[model samples]
Target: MYICLEGIDGSGKTTQIKLLESWIQKCGIDVLRVFEPTDNEVGKLIRKLLQNPDAINENFQITLALLFAADRTVLMRDITEAEALAKIVISDRSFYSSMVYQNDSEWIAEINKHAKQPDLVILLDINPETAVSRCDGMDSFEEQNFLASTAKKYLELADHQNFMVVNANNGINKVHDDIKRIVAHKLGMCI
Candidate 1:
């Protein structure tokens, strides 16, 4: 099972992924943990570009989109191999981020066609203001207005068979319970 947690920054995906991985392990499931914008060379370049908002002009968006795709192309191999070993692969972000953050959705999808699709996508939905406040506007991506638009796009993308939406305004424990319930039910895990 490949499970991905998606949402705007400060939506607690990092926190929840850690908790979920710990719990799943307690349930005797071997989990392979990974995250996008990985520490690879391409991912490092993406991180570098993102820190300078000036570098993210309209034309550069396409370059960022391609970078994300190239990064995921490498990640998909590990995800596929781990899943084949009966490991539950959990990822913090995926090509889905590119779909939402980048300008051209169709082109983003095409570029990421080689990426592995998640069997389940749990979106940690949160108010844009609340999300930005949580992260302290750490990067260009953490701006409230930008996150608002991105949140809307995420919700729109959530209308899918494999998608699960979790309201993230609640306290961390409550949000985690909801994720656990959703995952347990969807995957038929007794954990």
Candidate 2:
């Protein structure tokens, strides 16, 4: 199963992912934990550019969209080719995030063209205001208008089809429990 966890920065996706992976492993499932904007050469440059917001001047939006797409493509290919022994692949971020960053409505229509869809897309839903304060003053794509826009986009995307939307405003353990419920329901695992 391909399971993806997505949300704005400071939404606790990174923390919860570790917990989720551990829980799944304890159930005797082999889990693959993968994250994007990888440490690969090309992805490294993209990460540097994205972090230095001031350095972006030309085609900034397109640059990030393409960079994320490339990273997802690499990830998708690798995961698909892996042996089935890895029962579940949990990704911290996935192609849906690119759609949010690009803020393109066409993304929803063309989403499947880029990469394989996940069996379950777990959205850690948090309002943009809460998301910003969670960052503790550091500014990034997740703190500004981008967060608002993306959160809206995510809602719109979710409305089109059924996906798990877990409220991330609560404490970490609560959020983890919610995710466990969702995953158990989806996979029909003993809870």
Candidate 3:
């Protein structure tokens, strides 16, 4: 099973993933946890660009989108091997993020054509204002306007069957319980 947790910055995806990993392990399932912008060569370049966004021009969006697709390709190779070993792969982000963050162009779609889709996409939904207040420093895409736009885009892409939107404004335990319920249902497990 390939599960993806996605949300804007400060939406508590990492925290929730950690909790989910522990629970999955308790169920005797081997879980492989991975995050985008991995430590590989292309991922390193993407991280560098993100940290130093000012060094790049407007063209960086296209470059970053392609880089993300490249990174996903690398990740999929590993995911395939893990799946062959019967491991459940959980990713922090996936191509859905690119669809939300990158330019709405055919090039972006074409580049991600070969990327693997998650069996379940859990979207931690939170208002941009609340999400912004939860974090300290801001990244290139963490600004108020950008996050609001991204959140809107994510909502647009969210589907009922494959996409599970959980309200993250609740307390951590409540939010985690909601996610657990959804994931359990998807996996046909009694939690």
Best by TM-score: 1
lDDT of 2 by residue, 12-97 (tens): 88999999999998998888888877667667878888777664454686666676777777777767864256568888887777
The residue ranges of model 1 lying beyond 4 angstroms of the native Cα positions read: 138-142, 160-162
Clashes of each: 0, 0, 0
Model 1 residue 76 lDDT score: 87
List CA RMSD, all candidates.
Answer: 2.0, 2.7, 2.2
Per-residue lDDT of candidate 3, residues 40-127 (tens digit):
9999999999987463466778788888999999999999999999998998989888888777757777999998889999999999
* Local distance difference test scores for all models: 0.87, 0.79, 0.88
The alpha-carbon root-mean-square deviation between model 1 and the true structure, to one decimal in Å, is 2.0
TM-score of candidate 2 against the unseen true structure: 0.87
Q: Cα deviation in Å at residue 69, candidate 3?
A: 0.9
Where does model 2 exceed 4 Å of error? 54-58, 105-114, 139-142
Model 1, 2-109: lDDT tens digits are 999999989999999999999888888899999989888988998998887676688778787888899889888888899899999999998888888887778888
| Model 2 per-residue lDDT at 57 | 55
